[model samples]
Target: MSSQRSSKTFLQLKYGEALDTAATKKSITSLLSSHDGTEVIHHCLKEGARWGMSPDSEEPNTLEAVYILSGKLKLHRPNEGSFLEAGDFLAGQPVSEFIVLTALEDSEFLYITSNPVFHYYSSDTRNLEMLAIEIEKKDGYTADHCFRIKELSMLVGEKMELNSESLQKLHFGALLHDIGKTEVPESILLKPAKLDEEEWTIMKEHTRYGATILRKTNITHFILAAEVVEQHHERYDGSGYPKGLRRDEICLEAAIVGLVDSYDAMTSERIYSKARSKESALTEIKQLRGIKYHPEVVDYFLSVIE
Candidate 1:
């Protein structure tokens, strides 16, 4: 898609043509943009995928409208939910809260916003998504692992009744938590046996590496995610690695990710460990509630999974 601007009064876009494009698994293409921060974007989302919108300080007072092109979507706010189908339109002005859209089926829509989000969606967010792909390719067993963590973590976040901003941080942070493993050598990442003490040491560095990777983006959301990635390995009882942050020392977002990450790891088939049953994983997680995990986080997580 060409992002070139035309000095003419009008520009025509042909079928399937986009002015600019960005994506992870789902995609967003900028169809038009204005200097005043308005944008018309084409968004595609896989069934069950979620997208969040909130008015932040950088773009407060932003107004948005969604015109569903196909499939089904659900709009979720604090206490109410509404469903939209093809030809349905939803619009609202900026609010102090967040609104989330979940694709009930493979869905496409035209997202028009008064404030600019093209750069964040196109650049920073796209970069992070690409990094996730890189991690999947680097370790074969990690296919969709980060994505699953994100989904489950969000469930827990929602269950915990976290505020809008915290949910956003949790969403992005969970997806990028293992991004640091990209820096680890393939030998250790793919090794079918347990990592030796030295190899384990290298493995532990991924938390810091993930933090570094996210910090370089310089985006507030991802910067906060970096903190989650850095501390996700820290234990509630101060027995975990990197910083060994205990209990309240670990951010709630990291604690959420850490708990979900551990559960996902246990339930996933790995080169070093066989997949554990859901019941088994839950049993272990429940046992370590206050020791390996935060007590509040464990309660909410159990509620989400159950």
Candidate 2:
């Protein structure tokens, strides 16, 4: 549809007519941004198509109904991907970071937008950094430790060659991995000796608490990062924490953060343990392989360090 014609503002849009011009990219890119008073739109796509959209930061509130008229689509945002089939419908101010739409097969969809239920701040890292500073205050070492993990996790992610969206989520998630520990008692967190089973239980609860905080923020980016926060402790062989989720059940970003976190903890001094040589930590992690860490993540991590 021609932008000039579409701009005429007709009461009705005929077939093949689009309220907003079709935005295309080699893969994914931003499709829309802030505009004047309530404007509803319709988009149509053919097979092998992809589109990404972001809401206005100043007015983050938006309610939308998207119906997949035909074919299949993979909607990716931040750390999650949603598969929409023909007849599937999604509603709400449902965008964070951005919405990625990819046609798995020949596809077409219709969307209607309206006022949103509530407004939320757009993506920002400064707020999260301040929160991290506060959470890390309890332990002098962790401030630097978390940053190291973040660097290594992103390095691993880059080795794996993740897309920008995946890398962003991985970076933030790795930095916030231990944020949940803030909720636990310092007695258990700062103990110089091994934690008793009871104290260990409280330590384990950090994942749940951390994810809860991210979810409560209602910010798309952090909300997307919550998967890593909650699942970083889960093991590849179904043996790790708050949940025993195994294999692909764990989010890849979370697994990467977990592996890096473990690697950093081993190499860095902590109140409860002596620092191990980098070589030793690498050897120990290599031994765990698929048993403790995701095999692909381990391999990529090794390549990154090597």
Best by TM-score: 1
**Per-residue lDDT tens digits of candidate 1, residues 41-141?**
78777776666654444444567787899999877655556788999987766434555666778888887877655654545454566677567656655
Can you write out model 2's per-residue Cα lDDT over 203-306, one digit (the tens) per residue? 99999998898777655456667889999999999999999999999999999998987887788776666899989999999999999999999999999887
Q: What is the lDDT of residue 284 in candidate 2?
A: 92
Clashes of each: 0, 0
lDDT of each: 0.72, 0.65
Q: What is the lDDT of residue 213 in candidate 1?
A: 90
Model 2 misplaced stretches (Cα beyond 4 Å):
1-124, 140-142
Candidate 2 residue pairs in backbone clash: none
* Residue-level lDDT for 241 in candidate 1: 82
